[model samples]
Every structure is written in structure tokens, then in C-alpha cells.
Target: MQFQPIYYDGELLLPKIELHMASCQAIGIVTDVKRKQLLMDQLVDHSNYYLFQAQQAEYMRLTVEELITFLNKITERNERVTSLMDYFALKEERKVKIKDLSPSKRMYVTLMRVFFAHQPTLVLEEPYFYLEEQDRRQLKRILEDLSKEKQILILTSNLEDAMISCDVIYRLNEFGFYPLDIRDSEEDKQEVLEQDQANITIQKISTKRNEKVILFNPPEIDYIESIEGSILVHVGGENYDCALTLTELEHRLLNFGFFRCHRSYIVNLQKVREIITWTKNSYSLRLNTDQDAVVPLSRSKLQELKALLNI
Candidate 1:
């Protein structure tokens, strides 16, 4: 018997890509804004796929709870409506209108609401920008779950953002879309090597206390914080003033499990005990130490920290 493929209008757009999506594939298209919009337009205008643009998509102006209730009606109770809502940590915002929610929250609701409503092949544009780390993680989970029966076409210019939940990545060139040889990329190889190396030596950070110099192992420190004009290095339960700049330390400890979670702090990912979400938007990292130090988390770098920590 001859095999049939999913229709992309009368003719296929990017035969190479269409052929690969014989089954649901989490595909990433790396391109600039103009090219991304062009692809989205083509998909919406010509294809049978559902396009989920965060800003432009139409989601019924329902409260979060109401949306879940509505999703249950469309795709049946089998749809993962409540779990998805919880995954995005939207339980507290159940009373607010979907339209009135924050940009990031609204984006999550729109994407999931559309999915449950149709479970259509998704063509998402710049889906990763402005997403907090937890939101991105939940989105990754959603995409992975949906990929079992739905094709996901993610369009973005940033490589790291594209790498989130994409199984196959294509680079858009002047000629056309081409496969990104990630395995052959030197930068990727270096990153893999760094992550693989188990033993990293962190001899010390030079410090001046009582007008005397001291050396301490970087791993022994819980975190580094910038206070006033001096850098404070937090050891087990005590703090010491360090001479080297935060930037310098970050560069040196990149191979280790250290991450600059915020502008004023660089944390040891190994010591991060838990991520506390104080508000819908605010987050902090609690460390596993005697003093139980807490470090500020940058909303922007949350995803980066997750990637580094493999959480």
C-alpha cells in the first residue's frame, strides 16, 4: 500500500521538513522576525495547521477556571486541562480573566487553550521569549506531552530558546531552511564536554580581611553576592570579602555547577536546595547550607539556570 502524508495546502511547503513530520515531530525553525512572520503567515494562510501566536491568537476571554471548564467540554475530560494549568502554576490566578493576565501567563493560557480546543498541529512563533524559567519548563512538558499526537513547529532566532523542546532544528538561510548540524557545532561540543567533566578544580577566591589575604575553594562557598562596592563570598556559615570581580569568577567557574542567577549574585547550582515562588512573578533560590542563604533569581535567567542545573 502507498503511504499518505499530511496535507500542507495543495503542495508541500519545505518538502524536506514535511517529509520528516510523517509523525509528530517537535521541530524548531531558527530565523529572524521577518522570516518567522513570513512562515507563520504561510502556515495560517495555506496549511491545515493551527497557528498559536501569543499576541495575535484569539482565546475566549474567560477566567482561568472557566477556560479549564471550557477545555473539558471541547476535547472531552481526557484532555490535560487542569494539569497543564497547574504546570504553568496558574492556580492562584484562576479568578482573573485570561486577557487580563500577565503577558507570559496569557501566552500559556492561549497556547494550552487552543491545544485543548483543537489539538491541532501547532506553529508557534518566538515562543520562548519573556517566559520565566518555570513557565518554560512547563511549556517544555506540554510540548513533550503533545508531541505524541501533535506536530510542533517552533519559530525563533535564539538557538538556546529553540533547543528547549525541539527534536529537530532547521536554520533559515537566504536560500531556504537547512538542517542545523548541532553535533558538529564546536560550541555545542564544548558545552557537552564541560557538562560531562565530573571533576572541576576550584582552588580559591582571593580575599582581603583584616588587611590580610586568604584563599578559599570556590566549591566550598554557597554563593557570591555583591554588597555596596565589595563582593562578599559566603562560605559554609560565614562571609568573606573577595577581591576578584563577579564577572571574572563567573568566567572561571562556568565549567563548574555555578550560575549567575542574578546581576548581584552567582550561585552554586549544586547547592540550590529549592526554587521558591514568592509571587506569580517573583522567585528565589534557597541554598543547602548551615545559614540557609537565599539568592535572588533573575526572571530572565531562570531558564538558563534550569538548563545549567539540568532541572
Candidate 2:
């Protein structure tokens, strides 16, 4: 299905979107919240699309089993509630009212409506944002199964979540919409290794935008994230494709106060203003930037970070 260009507030939110959803595979569009909302709204206007929005209304008064039964009855499906409960891994909580379940569990139960959807195309918004790991796996599995017969479209603000279930992924923002290359081949792995063997020759990190190479000084970079075998150099509020591996960039930017904070992230310490402790062991570094960027600080690296700052 193709959508015409969309504009909101005199700014283009999306260009011509031509999407051909393949069967047995989910397609994801990694976009910002506003754009995701806009796209979802447009999908809602289409009667052939089944939109499963985040925090969609649920039967809070009904027990988990009752809710599933009601959905089955209304959809006129023959699948028994017991099997559905087991498939959703809700057998243990079947008797619990939707309101009594935890936020994650409730959202998981609410998502059951998708499995019974009659639409030929299913569109979901941030399906993994509020889910726990176990629930995420279950949902991914169900979506994969559903994709065998239905065209699935997942709209998420997170690339990681999209990678979990999407066979093909695209990124859309103000800069423009484009496909993200998440595939890793032997050549790509060799290139990374070859980069690791090279010494830092320059301080300016090279990145690409719109098929043009752009060099950035280390200080101007907010952080570098390695996502699904792709290196993204983030600056200000935008990100660009990077050819160099994180290890090479880390070695090049070490003299400029960049810290390898996580397995997949390297942050510019000069931009870090707060060490947020979300849990006893989970930590994040909040950047002092206009966009309020935050990156995860691995548990194993916390002590090293504290030692570096003399905390």
C-alpha cells in the first residue's frame, strides 16, 4: 500500500511512502513519536487497516480469562479461551482482573485483540515500549505467526525493538525517510576488524548523511551507538550513518573525553551532566544537551566510571 506525502504544521512529516508489506515478515518504521502518531492516525482512517495503538482501551473490569473469552466470542472465533490464555502465558493470571494486573501484564492482555483482528493489514504503535522481556518475546512470536497470513506493520520510536520483530526496517524523520541497513555479512565483519587494526589518523569523525560524507569534531558529537551492525553518530538532535566501527572511534576520541559507557554506546563525557540511577544497579548518563539525550551506563562499567570521576 502507498500513502501520499503528508505535511503537518507547514512541515513535511513524510514524503511519498510506498510500502509493499510482505507475507510472513513484519515491516517496521522507526520514527519519532509525532510522526508515528500521524502515520497511525492516517492508518486509522483506512477501514482495511487494524490499528493497535499503545495503551489502547481494555476491559479493565473483566478478568484476564473473561476478557479473552469476550474477545473470542465477539470475533466469533473457535479458539478456546484456555488455549489462548496458555498461548499468551496468562494462565497463572487468568483469574486476575485486568485492573489488578501490573501495568505490563495489562498491556500484554490488551494486545490479545490483535490476534483476533479481522483486518488483512495490522498496524501497531510502540508495541514493545511497555512490555517486559518475556512478554516481548511472546508478542514477537505471535506477530511472526500472524504475519504468515496478515501483513504486519510496526511503528516504533525505538530501533532496537523494531529489530526484534521486523524483517525490514525504515527510519523516518525531518531529514527524510530512508531504509536502515541492519544486515551483517562477512565483508562487513572483516571491515570492522580491519578498522580496529588502523591507528587514529585524525580527530574529526567521518559520518554520512544523504550519501555525503561529513566530518565531525569529537566535541560536537553527543554519542555513538552501534545498532544492529550499523554505526550511528548522533549530534545535536539528529543521527548520521558512520562507516567506522565503535572501537576505532573510541580510540580516536579517547583523548577528547569520550567514554565507552556501554557495549554498544560511546558517550562524550563533556556533554554528560547527570548520572541517573534508575535502579540499584541500572544507570544512565543524561546529556546536557538541547534534546536531553540519555544513554545507558552498563552495570559493569559503573565502577570504572565512578573511579574516573573520583566519586
Tens digit of lDDT per residue, candidate 2, span 126-213? 8888888788878877887899999999999977667667878888988677776543222223333344445646868889999999
Q: Model 2: how far is 93 from its true place, Å?
A: 0.6
Error of 1 at 146 (Å): 0.1
| Candidate 1 clashes between residue pairs 3 or more apart in a chain or in different chains | none
Once model 2 is optimally superposed onto the true structure by TM-score, how far is the C-alpha of residue 256 displaced, in angstroms? 10
Clashes of 2: 0
Question: What tens-digit string does per-residue lDDT give for candidate 1 at 259-286?
Answer: 8787767898889899876444446788
Off by over 4 Å in 1: 1-19, 22-24, 45-47, 57-61, 74-89, 117-120, 183-311
Candidate 1 lDDT for residue 58: 39
Q: Which candidate number would show the highest lDDT if scored against the true structure?
A: 2
| Lowest lDDT block of 10, candidate 1 | 183-192
Error of 1 at 219 (Å): 25
